[model samples]
Target chain A: MLEAIILTVITAATPLLLAATGELVVEKSGVLNLGVEGMMVMGAVAGFAVTVSTGSPLLGIVGGAVAGVLTSLIFAFVTLTLVANQVASGLALTLFGLGLSGLMGESFVGQPGIKLQSLDIPGLTTLPFVGKILFGQDILVYLSFAAVFGVAWFLNRTRAGLILRAVGDNHASAHALGYSVIGVRYVAVMFGGAMAGLGGAYLSVAYTPLWVENMTAGRGWIALALVVFASWMPWRAAIGAYLFGAVTVLQFHAQALGIGFPSQFLAMLPYLATVIVLVAISGNRRATLFNTPSSLGKSFVPDR
Target chain B: MMRLELVKRAEKSRLMSVLSPVFAVALTVVFAGIVFAAQGHNPLSGIWYFFLEPVTSLWGVEQLITKATPLIIIALGLSVCYLSNNWNIGAEGQLTIGAIVGSIPPILFPDFVNPLVLPLMLLMAMAGGALFALIPAKLKTSFGTNEILTSLMLVYCSNLFLDWMVRGPWRSPQGYNFPITIDFHEWAVLNAVDVGGIYLNLSAPIALVLVVILAVVMRSTLKGFEIRVLGQSPRAGSFAGFSNRRMTAFAFALSGALAGLAGMMVVMSEIGKLQPVISPGYGFTAIIVAFLGRLNPVGILIAGLVIASSYLGGEAIQTSLQMSSKLATVIQGVLLFFVLAADTLILYKVRLVTGREGEGARA
Candidate 1:
């Protein structure tokens, strides 16, 4: 029972970890893409549709990532090139993604989905709790951990990452230093989009193994909050995602246990927890300012 | 590969500012046509059903007005919030809470059948919305929380609360197991005015009055100037003695009140009773309305009608073309993207540069 619960929590946390990690990079690059939810939903629908058509969950995941990249490019063009308000453009991207995905997935509703299978090593498959907990998970679960460590390394140890961070911190300075601010931001935004897509694909192909309109159901927004709770650190985001996943799983368990409270109220736990967590994290003015990218969410236009 | 570059203008272009929305609508229509064609339908017929057929009949026009009323009211309040630089994205929650609070007089005190019940309900709803909105405002002022996330989070909480209410304590005895409340008494309902054989709800005129009042306030009041100054530059606003904290609270409360009023109107005029769900995403849709209207009261009113028609058109296509009503949401989203993109033309000139010449110049 304990191992089963842990596995469920990991499954739940993987998507959040995936998305929050991507958003952390985007914010570190000084671009706030509010459309994580949009890209995510698009990925979910596209991933599900492709999986259904191709009978391969692997291709579906890739299709979802590509869909996210394509969606993020629209945002890139509007904000990075046209220099539109990043906040509004992000909101537009979200609304567009939600609507477009719903329309696209209209036919896929109520269809039985093919779940992504878990990995099985020859000898490790029959091992007790620890082995199953660590080695018996699906491919995306492993990828999520790899992504966190990869992002942590990329942000701290890489020269290109330093350039990306520099652009986010002070675009004008980075521009004067001969780095392409818009180019770096575009890559960051697209990366964020791809990660969000992967997260969404996991929802449709692994977590629930079904296509539902707005299946993301505010997870994208929660991922956004996770970035803040982590103070923009990749590893911290992983911890935050797992904590939220625990809360979510515990709530479901409580509902199953018939604790007598209304299920609706129980359902409110994650969202309420998010608000409380945000207050606690952002309440520290010095800490928040210490880590937040100076140029985050501000539009950049390079002058020749 | 060709790349797009923007060069800032010395001053905002008046012509482009006025024409941006028009250009956005045109662009959305064209893209919508392509979407329809891609789905194995005639693009022209899809356009006709999606945009034109909804407003051709008197009944259709009534439905348009009915839908536009709440959107206009909600957008008007949002304009104030946006203009003051307060991002109140949780108007949907405010609306839900407003509907609940407004329904109290009717559901709890069904025996109270005086004209005063309606007015009192409206006031209670506005107060409910304002107070609910102040949650994020207070958090921002005290804890310095990000209002956007807090506000949005509250939406889910409020929605769940509403669902709990209808399914539990507030469920009507006579609702036949449906998750709904009892029918509201006549005094609690908003009546329609018959204007020469055409019936229009009282909420329509109320929305219009609000638009006019807000237009005047935004145009001439010192408060309006304060909102504008703060939004443009918080430094200048502080230097000029306008309090950012107070402005945040004020903007949120005002928008919340308006959203509450719209919610009350929706319950009183349309639904006529409380239910598990009261709105069809009107609060969020109003955000699109607020932007498409350029954050102006009169412009919002017009934009509200345009969007409301889309809702009708979505239904029309659902029946005529067998398309999902979600197509309306797609069109609205596309329209917003174009609006944001086109507004760029107001302040900058976009030029397409071919080849490495532009890249070399930048380097």
Candidate 2:
């Protein structure tokens, strides 16, 4: 039972970790992409449809990524070139993605989805308790951890990272220093979109292995909150995702254990935690300053 | 030939206001047709179902009003919030609380036929929604917290609470173990009448009246002027001695109240009972309606009806064409994008250079 619970946490946290890490990068570049949910849904539908048709998980991943980036491009156009409000455009993107995916994936409902195979290491598989819990997981789960460290190194140690940060902190200053602020933002936003798509792929190919409309079930929003909870740090995002994963996994765990509570209350537990975390992190002056990306949702329009 | 620029010193252009929406609708219809064709469907048939089917039938018209009522009510409140440059994304949560609260009176006093009961429910729903809105409002005022996140996050919790109550404490004993509540009595329902044997709910007229009243208030009232000033220029508003904190609270509370009333009307008029899904995304969709209406109450009234027609048409298409009901949602979303894009072009000219574009670039 303990083994199953541990396995569930790791599995559940994978999608959030991927999505939040990508968002962390996007926010660091000073662009708030509210289209994460939309991108994820697109990814979910595209991934599911590709997997069912081709019977190959590889195509599924590519399809999901393409769908995610395609969806994100709408946001990129409106916010980047048109200089529309990021928050409003993001909301619109989400609305568009949700509706589009629901229409596109309507036929794929209830069909079996492609299952991502777990790693089979000989020596690690022979290990008593740890093998099944750690080594036996799918490739995506392990990639999620590597992604955490990779993003950390990318943000803290790379020259490209510095430029991105500079663009985010002050577009005017960056432009004055001969950087194409709009160009950098477009790339960052697209990268974020691609990553969100991969997260959706993980859901369809690995997690549930089935198609369901709106299956992300507000996980995209939770991933958004996880970025806030993580204080915009990559390693912290991993921890926060795991924590939320536990919160999500434990609901089912408690139900399995005959823990007496209305299922609705249990379902609401993670959202309540989100509120608590937002309050706790927001109330303090230093915490808010450190966690919030300075130019998170503000639009940048160079004066003509 | 280059077009001549017309210089006019005017606050607003009547032609621009009238033409923009028509242009937007036309553009949206064209864009949506392309999308439908891409999916292997006939664009003409798509337009017929999306635009024509809902308006042609009596039942379709009723459904259109039923759909428009909630949207207009919620959008009316949201205009105030948006006008103040405050984004209350949790109207969904506020609406849920409103429905839950409003349903309480009807559930507890099943046989209560007093007119006061309905009024109290409306009051409580408004109060409940307002109280929910107050959390984000106070948080922002006192701590500078983002109302968008706080209010939005609250929605998930509120929905869960609603789900818990109906499925657990409030579940009807004789409901055959379904996760639902008792059916509301006739007294709790929104009263409607038949004129020449055509049935219509009271909410239609109420919504229309509210739109007129709000339009007048927005154009003529001191508070309305303050909201506009705050939205256009916060510094100027503060300089004028208008309390930003008070305005924030007022915007959110007023928005919440209308959302609450919307929720009450939904339960009383349409469902007549509490269900697991009390709303069909009315609160969130109203955000679209509010913007599409350009934040004008009268514009919102028309926009609400138009959007509601799309919903009916979407349902019809879903049944007849065997397409997803979500097709309507896609059309609505595309409509928003095209409309907003059109609005931009209408309000601001897009310049194109015929020659030597690089000559103008000095940076």
Candidate 3:
């Protein structure tokens, strides 16, 4: 039972992990894209629709990423190109994506979704609970772990990573140093969108195996909080996602076990947990105590 | 190019002001046409049915108001918060709480059909929403927590609480195990006014009156000036001896009260019984209405009407064209994109980049 719960946590956290890491990258570039939810929903709809039509889970993942990127382009154009307020533009992106995805996925509801086939490694599959927990998962689940490590390494070790970090930290300063802050941000935003989309597709293709209206169900918001809970660190974000996932899964398990608490109240437990974590981590300083991109949520407009 | 331009241009004329939202609609139609074509539909007919059918029918117009009433009220309150530079993203939660709290009056006092009961319900809704909002306000003022996150996170709590109430304590004994409350009595219902050929609810007038009152308060009052001052520069506000704590609390409370009013109106007019899904994303949609209205109460009223049309039209298109009603949502979202982009032109100028000149401009 404990092992099953552990497996559920890992499976549940994977999508959030994918999204939060991407948002971390976007925030690092001094842009706050609130459209993460919208992008994810678009991915969910697009991935589900395409996967249903094509019968390929891998194509669905790609479709989801592409859909997210396309939806994010609206945000990029508004905030980056037009110099609209990042927060407001992001809100618009979300509204647009939510509406668009709902429209597109209306017919796709109640249909069976193509699930990503789990990898079956001979040696790895032969091992104990650890092997089953780690190696015997679907492609996206493993990729989510790879993404966290990849983002961490990229943010810390590489020169390109430094440029992206600098763009996020202080766009004006980065521009003064001859780097294209807007260009870097545009790229980062698109990447963030792709990751967010992939996360949503994970829900439709791997986790739920069906499309539902607003199926992301504020997981995007949870991913947003995870960025803060992790204190904007890549590795911490992964852990935070799992932590949230564990809490969410526990709520379900509790209800299934017929625990004393009202199931409705219990259903709200994960969101409440997010608030508590947010309050605990966020302080008056308006800066993360850990390594946060200093210029997160600010727009970078290049002049001509 | 090296010189400073008038960073502040005069506000658009009244004609242009009205035209802007219309223009946004036109832009939406154009983009929506493209979207429909992408989805393999005739663009012109699709766009026409989207707007014209909803307006032509009496029933369609009624649905529009039914859909729009909560949006306008909620957006009216949100304008004040946005203007005060306080982003209260949890109006959805406030609305949910408002419905939960307000329902108590009708549910508990089922035998009492006094007019005052309705008023009390409204008052409780305002208080509930205000009280819920105060959590984030107090947190922001004391712990310096982000009100955006706190308020937004609270929405989930409120939703769950509402769900619990409907499924548990608040569930009607005679409801036959359904996840809802007993139907509200006729006295509890918000009476619809018969206006010439069409009928409209009292909520419309209430929303319009509140919009005017808010506009007057925002434009003509000292408190309004203080809110504007505080939003633009907290330091400047403090330097002028204005209280940040007081203003922050006021902004949040006021916003919460409006959201609560929206809740009362919703329960009174549309959904007579409390359910888990009482609000069909009205709280969140109101944020869009608020911004699209440029955070002006009057602007939000107009924006509310326009957005409300999309909801009505979305349903119309779904049934008529066999297109998914979700397309209406997509259209509204697309409309928001155009409106935001158009708003940017009003606030800032976009310049093209050409090689090293862009680099020099940055420096």
TM-score of decoy 2: 0.93
| Candidate No. with top TM-score | 1
Q: What is the full ranking by DockQ, best candidate first?
A: 1, 3, 2
In order of appearance, the predictions have TM-scores of: 0.99, 0.93, 0.94
Candidates in order: C-alpha RMSD to true structure? 1.1, 3.3, 3.0
Which candidate, 1 or 2, has the higher TM-score?
Answer: 1
Single out the weakest 10-residue window by summed lDDT for candidate 1 chain B: B193-202
What local lDDT score does residue A2 receive in model 1, on the 0 to 100 scale?
91
User: What TM-score does model 2 score on chain A?
Assistant: 0.95
Q: Which residue pairs of candidate 1 clash?
A: none
Global CA lDDT computed for model 3? 0.83
lDDT of 2 by residue, A89-192 (tens): 78788888889998889889988887978877768975888898778887777778788998899888999888988888888888788787788898888888
By the lDDT metric, which is better: model 2 or model 3? 3
| A-chain TM-score of every model | 0.98, 0.95, 0.96
Q: How big is the positional error of residue B275 in model 1, measured in Å on the Cα after superposition?
A: 0.9
Steric clash pairs (candidate 3): A29-A168, A30-A168
Every model's DockQ, to 2 decimals? Answer: 0.87, 0.42, 0.55
